[model samples]
Target: MTANLSTPPAIPAGTLPAGTLAAAPQPRLPAPGGLLLRPWAAADATVFLAAYRDPEIGHWHTRQPASADQVREWFDRYGADWAREKGAHWAVTGGGGEVLGRIALRGIDLDDGVAVCAYWVLQAARGAGVASRALTAVSAWALGGAGFHRLELDHSTRNRASCRVAAKAGFLLEGVKRSAAVHSDGRHDMHLHARVRDDGPPA
Candidate 1:
């Protein structure tokens, strides 16, 4: 009796794909309705400061920028994060390069294929579906192009506007995390909204 012990062809390792899992590059993702998702730049400090002045913005994102110097520092960190494949943040802009808002996919978890989405539109752009548009575009790209399986977005239940944006973006409301977050105003019960790879067509 004889037995055969043959070695199989070696599989490729460490040849990961780009635009997924690990941040490689921020691809140009388009947000229809006259919007573009571009990487944040140092020159955007002024616009960011302007947005930061909005009451809703200040109330929601406690870290209100006090000076252009602070903004530049934040910009530097954002750049480093992208280069290190840590996270992706983008400026929601218009045709003339006017900054309207910000959108980001941060806190990425490769093990669970999860990432948290954060976004805000300036006061001038509110009620125009800007956040929803940007969120939908970014989330789709993150799932389809970036290879992330699940995207999560949370907002203080008190932020009715953010809830609307999340709902319009097709992120299914996934209940709440009681006293899970502290906002500028106070502690909040965070409403967790999420979308998965198999969630099907975006709404």
Candidate 2:
């Protein structure tokens, strides 16, 4: 008997439905200390540009918007990413509704229930637990309500601040990826951290 090469084998269903994220409007998550993670808005162009222009932020995040128009375009792309269930981005706002930072889940794979988290805060917002709080809030939502199984984040090994934020958010330190990231200075080792749905709440 000849094997049938044209037929493909069956695969298991995805962990989440296709419309899990796109079916509903993106939500605004409230974090501790009166911080809110809301969808990015058109009016955020100014602060978005300013964030990229920040030396530390620029050094870490290499993609910088050259103008307000470019920033707006990026915002549009972010919305599109949401509709496509490809990614989710949020503007971290303070009690007064001022943009203090950003948090996002990139490279989403619903079938695998996995994504990579990224975030940054303005200089004024640093040293205040902004990143950790926002990160923890988002992780809870993603793993609980959104049905994601795992979330991962990595940063240059030299960035002790980010390491602390990841730990505070309950992302256990996995291991190091040698020369895995590039920064303004040069290529650097990256420390990988991750949280699974079973990790429970942040301690």
Candidate 3:
């Protein structure tokens, strides 16, 4: 059977008509507590740098604290990528104008109906359901507009917080790959999870 390469099937959080998945776009989404999820702008780099400064964030993320020049370059390349649709990133912000984290749908494959969802939230934002909300909003858009059927997420085995976020986002534990990569001291295991289009509900 041929997949719909143009528009992905919508998996609405709420009930809808039988053919709604094939119908118009779902209502625009607002992040939890009316947080805004939108594309990152150049001015948002300070927030990015601040969020990355936490040692905990650096431990999991390969990239260290970004330099001012590096942040500019990063934003430049980020904007270009989104403009070309190669991939996209969004900054998660609270109603009070605090930057919570960033979520991205990279490695998009329209033919295969798949993409990679990756994110990291500030320490203060942890356990606040921010990551889950950001993920849900992005997943709905990808499934409803971008033709993605499966979304994969990965993290170092030591990142329990990330693992919890994946579960909260409705991704099931798939498997683990030993020595997935070389860490500062040695190899590290990687946890893999996925949420298929048919999955029940997203937290």
Candidate 4:
């Protein structure tokens, strides 16, 4: 028999205050191997555009900015999201400040102390643990100083590299959402993963 999918009953009030995230400046987190996770800048439009242009990124991300102007607009939106406490996005950069990847917490729900994580590494930076390092840094900040209780990550089941990154970053596989995500080719199942604050430190 199919399991019931009704909304669960509401619990107690929010774990954190309303302005918990917005009250503080977005931090520039340090990752392993001299990598840095910082807010996106207006000058990053060029590399931002290039990231979406990559075939693999395009295949999974599915949305692209048509021009530098569009990328700037996206940067603006990201700033607004940060101000509104709805999301947080960061650019993973090398020691020389070269853009290496992107990481973010989307769909932030302060009431529930939860958010979803997303990330992508540039083609040149792949296989160097860039994504995992960025993810681990963000997760630590989110669950520790940021006051978030849980962080969730989901990716297309076919994206084996992403699955590996999640695992390496301490996000345990929760389950699959059958045919839950749409890709360039068609719909595909998604693997859901999560790391809660109580999970303790990463191995």
**lDDT (CA) for every model shown?**
0.82, 0.94, 0.74, 0.92
Against the hidden reference, what TM-scores do the models get?
Answer: 0.87, 0.93, 0.80, 0.92
User: Which pairs of residues have clashing backbones in candidate 3?
Assistant: none
**Candidate maximizing TM-score:** 2
Superposition error at 117 for model 1 (Å): 0.3
lDDT by residue for model 2 (1-203), tens: 99899987654432676898999998999999999999999999999999988899998876789999999999999999999999999999999999999999999998898999999999999999999999999999999988999999999999999999999999999999999988988899999999999889989
lDDT string for model 4 (53-74, tens) is 9999999976789999999999
Candidate with the larger TM-score of 2 and 4: 2
Of 1 and 2, the candidate ranking higher by TM-score: 2
Candidate 3 structure, TM-score to reference: 0.80
Residue-level lDDT tens digits of model 1 in 38-74: 9888889999988888877888888778898999998
Query: What ranking emerges by TM-score with the best candidate at the front?
Result: 2, 4, 1, 3
Q: Give candidate 2's whole-model lDDT.
A: 0.94
Model 2 residue 61 lDDT? 78
Instruction: Count clashing residue pairs per candidate.
Output: 0, 0, 0, 0
Q: Which stretches of candidate 2 lie over 4 Å from their true place?
A: 1-14
Q: For model 2, name the residue pairs that clash.
A: none
